[model samples]
Target: MMLGLKTLLLFGLGGQELLLIALIVLLLFGGAKIPELMRGMGKGVKSFKEGMKEVDEVKKDIENEVKKDEE
Candidate 1:
């Protein structure tokens, strides 16, 4: 079943295209380092999201404080 599903997806790909992409990634980062690269990517994205959340909270608090000062 798994093999059948994978075959269906690969049916649309020509051999050399996949090979070219695989070679590029291999050259950029060796086989053993890809997982660590992906993990760091995930952490960077998470940190960016948290930073945005903190900025938004600070903006909201400032707006509330300004409103209180006006009243």
Candidate 2:
């Protein structure tokens, strides 16, 4: 079972390859800075979601106005 799982994970990337990439990231940023990086990414994602909600609301308003005009 473990072997099958490992093979699935390594379909395109070997275990060594993944480990090397992770090691590079850790070395470049250090473990202490990872949380701060993740926090900033979270804030960015939240802001994007809020912006999308505003756009959707505006689209609904426009559609309602168009329907009223047709009536």
Candidate 3:
């Protein structure tokens, strides 16, 4: 099963595809920027999570305020 998968992957990329991707990344970001790029991605995900949590908090607060106002 695994051998079949590896064969498919090898056929897909072969040597030339791998070389092309490597050259593109090297030209675009050079060596030093890869980690920075990944770090920024991590921070973006974190900020998204925090923003979602804040939204959830505000929603709950609004619900409570409405309940209190009704009472």
Give the TM-score of each candidate.
Answer: 0.65, 0.70, 0.58
Q: Write the per-residue lDDT of candidate 2 for residues 1-38, one digit (tens) a residue.
A: 47645885868777787788779989999999989987
lDDT of 3 by residue, 14-70 (tens): 667767877898899988997898799889978998999999999999999999999
**Per-model lDDT:** 0.84, 0.87, 0.85
True lDDT of residue 65, candidate 3: 100
Q: Residue 3 of model 2: what lDDT?
A: 68
Which residue window of length 10 is worst by lDDT in model 2? 1-10
lDDT of 1: 0.84
In terms of TM-score, which candidate is strongest? Answer: 2
* Clash pairs detected, candidate 2: none
> Local error of candidate 1 at 16, Å?
9.8
Q: For model 1, which pairs clash?
A: none
TM-score of 3: 0.58
**Runs off by more than 4 Å, candidate 3:** 1-26
